[model samples]
Target: MTGPSKKTERETFAAYCCDEATIDLLKAAAPSRGWSENMVFSGGIAGAVRALGAMPCPEFLIVDLSDSEDPRADVQALAEVCEEGTVVLTIGALNDVGLYRDLLHAGVHDYLVKPLAVDVIKAAMHSAEEAMNAVEEVEEEGPASEGKTIFFIGVRGGMGTSTLAANTAWLSANGGESTALLDLDFHFSSSAIQFDLEPGRGLLDALDNPNRVDGLFLDRAVVKPSEKLSILCTEAAIGVVPRPAEGALEHLVDTMANTYRNVVVDMPRHMVPEQPEVLNTATDIVLITDLSLSSARDCIRLKAYLKTCAPAASVHVVLNKLGAVPAEVEEKDFANSIETEINARVPFDAKAMLLAVQQGTVIADHTKSGKVTAGMKAVNSLFTSGSENADGQKPSWVNKLLQRKAS
Candidate 1:
């Protein structure tokens, strides 16, 4: 099958890999090789085929056949939809020489096995570049331009949503990323207090008049506890209803996105008019709940609400306070009951958690090792690795942190 004639332009590259590791390797290796920002990363071969079938193919394409039943046939299917002069690279789990030869003969530019090192992937990309014979410099997009907002909400009150959000943002900041923690609780927020910071008037001012919320105003409004961390919160008077201007939350989140590498929003349990807008702007949503049947039921309802409100945002359910869970509901049963997998479970640590709250700090700062810390580390890994696999495998960084705590 032939596609339209190739328009003369700088060659672009796109990839649909089976896992996050390969995607990370590609993102790290792309920039030094002059690949343009027109890159697309999706899930495996099926996603690549579906996405590219409707659009003009890039000069270079990479797809994974690791999960394919017939690798050769999959490549052949991809070739049928690919335009002429496109260099297709395949990565798979199969390491057989025959399979490599078959893929090469089926119009695949190259085939590499899984467990590939960065250097190997870079070499494969370079080969594709050489095959295309198209090289040009492309502008680099900074992290701020691609900043992501993560929303954390409790499935029920007292689920420790603020704690998770605070620590996640803290970890992001300490991990060398500029991070912001926005507390949207309005009246009763503890995010700022958790960081040992006083509530600032910036959030209230922004909510009152979103039209005046520019980058400069945001910069001045946030409280910087560290070089990379900023907090935007308010302790508004109780009984005072907050009527944020129509676009106030969006404007604030947008401005924060443009300024920080990561933004963590702590959403209140009660749904406000701005809740939908905040969820819609988030790249991820962390719904915190306990292991109780009531929390699980509430989680299902909240998950449905998120699906309807912010369909694009990825939602992860974190089961907190696991120590108090009765024997009547097991984790598996709880997940089944909610119709969603429990991404991370934080064992209840009443003493440590209470101390942290009393001291206006996070558990990580209060206790170095325990079930709670381990769970928090695992939760942080989900964001750092940017993997939706939810396999509950702690990242290497988390392991290092635990090792230090043990020592």
Candidate 2:
């Protein structure tokens, strides 16, 4: 969000073979999303690509045949010129369903009408990646490869939400899971900071040119924390506001859901409009809190509200800062108060937490089998367990209790 411009690791490039008007729009939109290099060849689609012999075949390609006198021939020739793995996106002048269907049937990844934007491009790349991954998975083993989307939300301020989210991504990535840590807490987001990365350009710039959002933009925006874990964060809190475009939060969650085996969101506490999108889509929503009275109340309110807004998402409440002695409020009482299971009770370790925060490390990484690390392992187990219900709704009593308290 409004962060500094991030460089791409993969040298993601794009080829835009379109007419003058489309070329101009694409040129203006490409750089804001931090597209590494975009080449616009203004000529008939077939001839322009044929000239290259796939010289600069991109991970993704966009072509506009809006003004072509022979639309069918132009499309066929463009398809013929594309390399085997290159994904082609076509922007057509027609709004006819038949035309759209035909293009899709002819091996086009996606078909957009005139006046395309970068978001469309990004969405197409995500789709292509998903399709390719699916094929790869099928080839490697079978069609049963499990995909997971997890959202980690801090029940209150400074409960180590960002750290846990980052570690979860690392765990998944290092364990051969494709993981993404998405930080949407605009002003005070910390995913990049924890990894010691300077705020770089990311989602904010992409929103400026939503139509041009693509895999290249994503590659440019995300910074690799490790070989396995990649982070997308709000750039440093600049003077400009750091808010996602309308429905952008939803789009982001949806895209992450499709691409990675594990999607971890470092969510803001305030349940804004897009909160539902992430919570509703998550395989499990982990609400982290401490064993304080305030935290318990907040957790209760969160569970209740979630029941209303995202009935299908399972809410797993975790009590952080658990010490040797039990919390003043008994665990059973806490669970009864919230009307849900207490997924984890992460122990308190002043030294571990302080060291981890000061050093910007996860508790699991900084310490051995201490109390804190053990609790973290327990939390990890909850994720692996089959008890989680991705589509289960909370009981109505949970909502009624929260409403009464609100009144």
lDDT of each: 0.72, 0.62
Task: Assess candidate 1 and give its lDDT.
Answer: 0.72
List where candidate 2 sits over 4 angstroms from the true fold.
1-134, 141-145, 236-239, 273-275, 324-326, 354-360, 385-407
TM-scores across all candidates?
0.59, 0.63
Model 1 quality (TM-score): 0.59
After the best TM-score superposition of candidate 2, give how far the Cα of residue 332 lies from its true spot, in angstroms. 1.5
lDDT of 1 by residue, 247-283 (tens): 6676677657645668999888686334676677777
Prediction 2 TM-score vs. true: 0.63
Model 1 lDDT at residue 127: 60
